[model samples]
Target: MPTTARVVVLEGDFGVCAIQELELPDPGPHQAVLEIYAAGIEHGQLQQVEEPQPLPVIPGREGTARVLEVGSEVTRCKVDDVVLITPWSADPGREPELPLVEFDDGTETEVAPAGSWGTNLILDEQFVVPIPNLMDKEGASVLGNTTLFAASAVRTAGVGEGDSAAVFGCAGVGLSTIAAAAAAGAGTIIAVARDDERLEAATASGATETLNLSSAAAVERIAELVPGGVDHLFDCVYEFETASRPGRTPVRDGGSALVVGLPGTEERQDDLDA
Candidate 1:
């Protein structure tokens, strides 16, 4: 008999999930069994639901977990240590070995690389990162995903002191990008959103100016504010027509416009500008 874990399983329909009991897998020589404390839902996982992938899928990509069991060769953490669970493997060059979810009757569903959204998960030692227990589990989980994404975008774009930056969409990740830019000494930061509430949130996150997409011409407004154009444009919203086109308009020639968000629907190659 193995330990039972509750997993969120998505069967035929898209965006629908059901709770089911599954038998936890034993840790492999280089793996650890983790008891997840807090999990964050990533947009990539949600996007997968609509695309063609195996059904009865488990959809969490990042989380905070407590190590419960380790294999003979595992040296990452002890039984009670807390760790961060990332979808990407510790070794990027190799394909990840995913654990199967076993049902009561001994039937098993083979899940690919992504870990389950469940109470217990068996993962490779490299996927579990030991962290200081100072921050709450919820906040730590967020830091691994959304905040990490924002930081990566800012650093990759080489946004420096006194550079004009604009963020299109003030959701969680968007707000995080705004804060990161301000912390890096950005000169003028413009936050664009479809509503006032998001704009207000962006302001609180250190945005110097806010624009409501529905109320005015976003590209023109941003150009007026930035003069020549913005140095960096980060788009985190996914509209059907403007997956990220509108935000790209404000970037100066040769400037970077990073699409940090996931698209709701895929567009044909012909529809996009070169």
Candidate 2:
């Protein structure tokens, strides 16, 4: 008898189902079987789905695993290979061998590839990134996602050496933005958050200064710290709309404000005489 795998299943009725006992499939010419090590939880899961997530869906988006088998034509991975699977929604311009993973949690039963919170996952060769031996697994997992966001934000802001930058929000991505900004040589970094604990962590992480946004003057205070106003600002706060406003108003006339936060919306660009 072949081994059976337990996985989560999602129904179209806004419900999650847990299903078990799946028969494993043999690797395709470009596929491999992976034993999941760990997976990261992201806020994207909270987004409302219209089509009702595919039934018997596996909902994890990011995970680390070890390969157990490979397809006849697959050259990317072999048994025992540690890999981090991050399937991009866009054509990442890399390769297409990797299949996008989705989880369905509607039903109470489990299913394969419908959820990756379980032990085993079958993936394509192009979807796997080799885990480096020297890198810490726990740290690299978070860094992988953060680095991608940082790269895009940094590039969008045209951040470079000597540019004064301020980052609003002290969460993972915010902290990553701070690090990237500092590495890019932003002379000053002001990290903004609502509490003292996270603010302190932001400072320790790389923020030149930290401020609490619980009060109304948080934006004004940050401007006072960066007298000339920041040249660039990165907003990573999803709920706080004001975070972006301060950086937008306080920054120099020619400065740029980059909003990387979520809950996508359309806002008219502030009209300022350049």
Number of the top lDDT candidate: 1
Question: After best superposition, candidate 2 residue 224: deviation in angstroms?
Answer: 2.5
Candidate 2: minimum summed lDDT over ten consecutive residues — where? 265-274
Q: What is the lDDT of residue 87 in candidate 1?
A: 62
Give Cα-based local distance difference scores for all models.
0.76, 0.65
Clashes within 3 Å, all models in order: 0, 31
How would you encode candidate 2's per-residue C-alpha lDDT over 95-117 as one tens digit per residue? 44433433332234322231345
TM-score winner: 1
Candidate 1: which stretches are off by over 4 Å? 42-44, 72-78, 104-107, 113-116, 240-248, 266-273
lDDT of 1 by residue, 1-274 (tens): 3567898877667577778888877877777888888888766667666666656677777789888888888877878898888765567775555677665445577665446478988887767778987769877876566776787789888889999998878888899899999988899999988889989999999999998887547667888898788999887775624433564465788888777755544552233334
The residue ranges of model 2 lying beyond 4 angstroms of the native Cα positions read: 1-4, 48-51, 72-78, 89-91, 94-115, 241-249, 264-274
Query: Clashes in model 1: which pairs?
Result: none
TM-score, predicted candidate 1 vs. hidden true structure: 0.83
